[model samples]
Target chain A: MQDVPELVAQAREGRPRAVARLISLVEGASPQLREVMAALAPLAGNAYVIGVTGSPGVGKSTSTSALVSAYRKAGKRVAVLAVDPSSPFSGGALLGDRVRMSEHASDPGVYIRSMATRGHLGGLAWAAPQAIRVLDAAGCDVILVETVGVGQSEVEIASQADTSVVLLAPGMGDGIQAAKAGILEIGDVYVVNKADRDGADATARELNHMLGLGESRGPGDWRPPIIKTVAARGEGIDEVVEALEKHRAWLEEHDALTRRRARRAAHEVETIAVTTLRERIGDLHGDRRLGALAERIVAGELDPYTAADELVAGLTDGA
Target chain B: MQDVPELVAQAREGRPRAVARLISLVEGASPQLREVMAALAPLAGNAYVIGVTGSPGVGKSTSTSALVSAYRKAGKRVAVLAVDPSSPFSGGALLGDRVRMSEHASDPGVYIRSMATRGHLGGLAWAAPQAIRVLDAAGCDVILVETVGVGQSEVEIASQADTSVVLLAPGMGDGIQAAKAGILEIGDVYVVNKADRDGADATARELNHMLGLGESRGPGDWRPPIIKTVAARGEGIDEVVEALEKHRAWLEEHDALTRRRARRAAHEVETIAVTTLRERIGDLHGDRRLGALAERIVAGELDPYTAADELVAGLTDGA
Candidate 1:
């Protein structure tokens, strides 16, 4: 493998292979990940990350492709990260997204990656943030993170973005499911894709009604606007892009963008620290300490809670 | 609040209200949880935990109700725990299940509780195991843990069970999705609910075919049997119980039961330890140490990886 700095430098210079390698390092938790993150640290925070999430079969991939085309037409660099954590087959859904996005495969101004978290520890909840950092440091003007909102981990995707778009389709029962999943709170923009289909208007109306049921939005609140789009045919792509830009302007003027990014950074830092602790726990698997504690719990000599407290105290005492 | 030992004694006497209060304490991460766990430790490991999981609308709740009735008829004390982590609206689905299970409400041999992961740290993955321990100590001969298998946390439910039953319905696209979600690997038994509906046999056949595709089971390995049931009408309920007993016997003969419980205990203990560490991290929220580290990362002076390492080191030093 090439040196971390060299790979990061090449990635920053818009080398697709290098970018791919950087992401692979992140996903695989390679030994050089620390060095790579350090090298990319100064170059980060340049990209505007937009999270696109919704239920399965909601045309998220198609919509993301349309948005990428629109952004490319506006003469800006773009990156697409399709994060699917539900499928045990890591790349199955991503391969489908890749076929749908083949038009931009050859575009030098666009970078597309799919992250399936089949075997990755901490899953996408841990990897996506770092991957976003990599893409941001690589100088992409706009980074789109597309994820299926069906899984719990997917909600974390929205928190990573500057503006989160929640997509819904007609007759999918996604409206109520989305509400129950608590996705309604994470979205900054609501999109009803496949709007050309029957019942699209009804879906939109239902979404609007649900949004209205919540505590009334104050003047200072950023009320998420619902939009309709036929992503397959590129219909309403311009309006969607306009909404994103307007949201961006709103964020900048209100200073929400900096705060959001800082919160995101804080979360990332905390996640890494906790993940390190988890790894340390794993290292104790073969050691006698953890095994003894578990045995004691199982033998009814110590409660799991007290044993857990003791274990934590023991692990941290040597620190 | 009552002391932990008294509460445990009350809960173990099959007092529903006491059980409810004990569970509430667990859900709230109450300060007395350690003492409660200690008091309950010796009383656990008696219940035969059966996990019932499937996609939504797959009749999981219906099947669970039927199974509870069957177990009760056999003179075994039964408890039902519906664990739903994906829904923020806690108890919504469980209310319906409670209605379906109303017949057992007045029976002293049956107890029911619904657990939602709303605001619960580590979600159901952390809470379900402890909840199972609580039920076990409550003198239940059989504990049914029902959960929706659509999200990542559902897999952990299977891990907690000695025997996991995966339910399916005809024409739900669940067969393939279940495989893709790797449910096939977790199931000890498979049930095709709504067998009176069309495509029930086809669903069973498809599942069998998929199971056949895996590395063939050896003579000593337990092969998951696919059975069809119309749980709404109480049809095939006896067969399901028979299958469960047969599987339980097989587990004992193969000495898999002890190994499974041991593994479950190990997982539960590890989860508690990790959760405790995470809480410690959360306590650092308002502290300047984490904020300072994030600031340095954002400013490009320190990489998140190195900063996380330093933070973990600092946190663990005085433990």
Candidate 2:
């Protein structure tokens, strides 16, 4: 159990073990999370975050591994957070994906971690940003947040990135599925992965059509680009990386990066605030006050609104 | 708009339109929600809540419709709340499912509504209970909450029910998929819908084995039964209904029903309290204080935890 300052100092010195330790603290919601966050606060905001998200079997892991290689080849320290919001059992379900990413496991400049909500309060909304900050502060020039599923949580996580890459596979009804999952609007770059498969061109064309159907942008606005990739063979990945770099350049040119980071920060703060208050409410359960109110609610003597009013008053008054 | 008392009275008298209006008010989080909840307080708690949850294409809608028919045969008023937590666009994605449910639309004894998170604070956790309270107060003898997708949100909603039924279709790797989705432990009953499909028996057997692998229960504990149904043709629905009734009886005999309801009430209250605090946080964003804090965070001058602390302090002080 190292002190927060020592752990953070080692992380800053490019120690992967130290970096992994800091992330573990944040991911587990360790009691010293506040100290760790405070120590890392001044060192964050340097890393470029790119979120890779899509449904299962879209080759998200393979694409992420390819991107890691691309970034590392250019001499940039990279980190990948393979987040699985769908799996409550955390690391177990993502074991196969981690094995897929094991090529980077031995690289000193690459860090890879898998995150699940683990039934935490505020779920991924509360945890992912903290982990991202840990990586950002650890001197990772680029952080890839690859999420497993295209549920609402995944969409929210993807939108937190400076640039989001939405992936699709051909012949899966993925164009309509992506639109239905609401990932169509959140992507800065779209990749029709497994390009060697049938209907790859159709998938790309349909995605192009869907992106065009979104709100029309001004001349200076960045249009999301669709790239086709056969990630397993590492084909067309350089183009994907090129698209990412272009999007990043556009963001910097437009000063949209700062605004996006601020929005992300605001969301993170709100999630933490709500989670803090929720913890207090959980404490009320231990003191029997919440239980008493719940009993009354079930007895038909009190409505939930009135019971909540009392609980909120208790929280504020105690504060 | 009609007055709250008039609406409650009409709902109590089994006026379907009045009941629908009341639910709409709660679902929308109308300003009059507090008044409506207060009015409906004494009339709730009589309905038996059963949660039906599974992945998409598992015949959840068909099974739900079948249950509605079986309950109607017993002359009990029934309501179904088809909740889709994954779809941010609410009613549009659920429109087809509603059409499939239109067979009961003309029946005065049946009420069906589709609900989505709609980007609401506290999400389905906040809205579902309030909606359920409205349905319970509206003279419905049974309320079925059918959720789309087998994600974390759906799992949470299912666990909130007094009797949760986890559904599966044969030959979809559904048993393992259900386990990965974390729905295995939440079910009070399991149904293998589309039982006419191949591997129905295998699916049931695998589910039974998986359920056995979980922590063993005592002889007095209620074992969740796996029922097979060809839901589209309304086969084996009577057995499903019987299983639900037997579970309910066991719950009452063990006094677990009261505990479950009280737990549900506690959760509802906590959600409301969190949501109320979150609305205050949202107000801070309007006042520019949150924006200022976010800017500082993005600048790496402050950590999100500290920002959240200050926000929470302001909330409590103002209260």
**Backbone clashes (count) for model 1:** 0
Docking quality of model 2: it rates as: medium
Q: How accurate is candidate 1 locally (lDDT)?
A: 0.82
Give the per-residue Cα lDDT of candidate 2 at B43. Answer: 91
Per-model TM values vs. the true structure: 0.81, 0.82
Task: Tell me the DockQ of each model, to 2 decimals.
Answer: 0.51, 0.61
In terms of lDDT, the poorest run of 10 residues in model 2 chain B is: B87-96
User: For candidate 2, what is the interface RMSD?
Assistant: 1.7
Q: Model 2: runs farther than 4 Å from truth?
A: A54-75, A84-107, A116-119, A167-177, A190-204, A213-217, A225-245, B52-119, B144-159, B164-210, B213-219, B224-246
TM-score, cand. 2: 0.82
Q: TM-scores of the first chain across all predictions?
A: 0.92, 0.92
lDDT (Cα, tens digit) per residue for candidate 1, span A161-255: 99999999988877898998778888888999999999999999899999884568678777788899999999988988888888899899999
